[model samples]
Target: MSNLPENSFFESLKAEDLSGVAYKNHLLKKKVLNYFSNFGNSTIQDLSKALNISTPKMGQIILELTENGVVQDYGKVDSSVGRRPNQYGLNASSAFFVGIEVKKEYINLGLTDFKNQLLKFLPHIPYNLDNTEEALDELCKIINQQIDKFNVPKSKIIGIGINLSGRINYKTGYSYSYFNFSENPLSKVFRTKTGFPTFLENDSRAMAFGEFKGGGIVKEEKNVLFINVGYGIGMGIMINGELVYGKSGFSGEIGHIPLFENEIICHCGKKGCLETEASGRALISKFYKKLQEGSQSTLSHRIKSENDLKLNDIINAALNDDVLAIELIDEIGKKLGRGISALLHLYNPELVIIGGSLAKTGDYLFLPIKMAINKYSLSLVSNDSKIVLSELGEKAGALGACQLVRKRLLQSE
Candidate 1:
């Protein structure tokens, strides 16, 4: 522990041993802990078979985790065998984590247990970039308030995870693309303001982390891609179960990927980026443009203002059989699919998860995206990859943020 870095819990875990035997034992323990943590209580045979390990080895790892207070034995399971197997589960009360998802308009915050359950969810607070100090102060106050409300002890709170929509240096907890304040380092500022260790990550990457930890996608496959479509589009790439943040921590800026050969300007100061043609903003812009041109649609009469055209509005209208909204979403979905097709060719990920606000459109969005992939992507790649909507939905980022802290705690132990 003395040799490990003070700022990282996982570093301490890694510092324990460098030998092959020790490494294998650590991995075995991790596998067992992860299985129980995710699948709830299970018997030794259940875990051994699920993890493809022998009963003796699995028992040894379970014993180690139990010693570390990471796992607890409940009672004996009445099985038709020589003896009843003891049931084991992760200690849900072992620790807690704070998750924060930062958007341009507001910040979503929540407190989660080791099982990633949202013990407390706070209302979204409007974020003002101009008043950085005030914003940070308010954020800290809310976090403290939530912790107090939950009656969680300070020692049990491992760290705070902040998810943002920009390039982030995960190692340094610095966001270069967003939060460009001069005097304060956002991570340090928040940590100082709240007195909690903090971890920062890209919003889409956080979504990926949440989805990965939440389960469903194949575990053996390492390459996974998450496409987040909201006011804008972003992507998170996980290769070998690790986030692929290229040089400068901006690897998954898929929205800025030049797709269309047009002159529509993007928020990133570029023209013809995928977001300009396919994002929620793009859909809203297109809707407004159509309305101005006197296009006949129910939305034209329903939406009095541009801001009134929410992603949910479009989705609901479409679900209610609004021809105009359906048509608009369909067009945007096609563009989004084309963008995803590019990802398929580039990454060849085993699973591609679509998440964010617009994902509520559900089948309306998935169909067009799949169609576009079929049309544009190589047949082999398209055949090998599966595209599905995220199960965590809007809470993915926040949940993933909490998982970050949980992972840090586990790694440190």
Candidate 2:
């Protein structure tokens, strides 16, 4: 394999191929890279102390990383005393990770550097998402096209993370909800077609990871629940600072929770799922029904047909203080809050983040959720959880996908 960090130290590459010493060194190098990724620039002594390695050994690893163009010298740290220690950090150009979010109506693509900083984000690429072979093919084609247009070489693209909805076993690289036409894993197909190491993640989990690492949560907040109120409601649960993936890696199916009494059948073919009333799809359905009932809204004419309407249009309308838009969002929020009350009773998370497309409605959505939580949940449990909107908003899923690639790559065996 090439000595470049992009090619040599990928997660797909087997560490068993390396000798014991080489494997240990590889593990240490990965630790160093992750340190730089999390803490940004650091002095050699600081790295040695934090990573629990001797200064000389740390120096050796740093030297190897620098030689491989993975770590770059960032001159000396500021100090009052003479002979300040030199700072080192990841070479931003060393490798790139791509994150792709496949939504019901469109795709979001993003690129992150070795430091896990988003370098580019392509939102709203028109594509229909479905559980069909042709849909998967078109998705792969769009991903490849987007990557090709990026100002990075194919070899330098170390990994790709594709986020999809429904039951996805990220470890097994299988998407149970979509692209299950063949026995082959969805990620395997993507890897073959995209010519890169690819991994599949649940969209809600990806969004939660994005918020956990990039946008939301302080260092103190470890337990979090990210409620993804997208086309369908999904959840990403974090407990004790680690994302919770159940035995089958299908942990966060909060949307399908049987919380309502309505006869509306969910996309999952169940009746009275939380998603039947508390999701973006639900929001659109309610808006259309209300419009047909002669409810007035400034956006009614703009949405002549169901196909012409979009989640964003409603969110934007709510943001502009449209009454009907706000009312429907509040209704969704109340139902979502009731569902979240159940989660709070179970998880007692330190934080609950409202994310996805509906998050754009802001206080129009947040206040009702807060009210509902207060009304439904026990004060002690609900009080511990801070309900807030997502800081990353629409970008969370794609950005989290990129973060997941780096995370899986550096995970110790």
Best by TM-score: 2
Candidate 2, residue 39: Cα displacement in angstroms equals 2.8
Tens-place lDDT digits, model 2, residues 110-199: 999988889999999999997787888899899888988999877778889999999999988988889987788888888888888889
Across 112-208, the per-residue lDDT of candidate 1 in tens digits comes to 8767777776645665433365665666776666666767766667678988786788877777776557566678767776777788888999989
Give TM-scores for every candidate, taking all chains together and pairing residue i with residue i. 0.78, 0.91
Residue 394's lDDT in candidate 1: 66
Residues forming the 10-long window of minimal summed lDDT in candidate 1: 1-10
- Report every candidate's CA lDDT: 0.78, 0.87
User: After superposing candidate 2, which stretches have Cα over 4 Å from the reference?
Assistant: 1-16, 77-84, 215-219, 298-309
lDDT of 2 at 85: 92
Native-vs-model 1 lDDT?
Answer: 0.78
User: Cα miss at 88, model 1 (Å)?
Assistant: 6.4
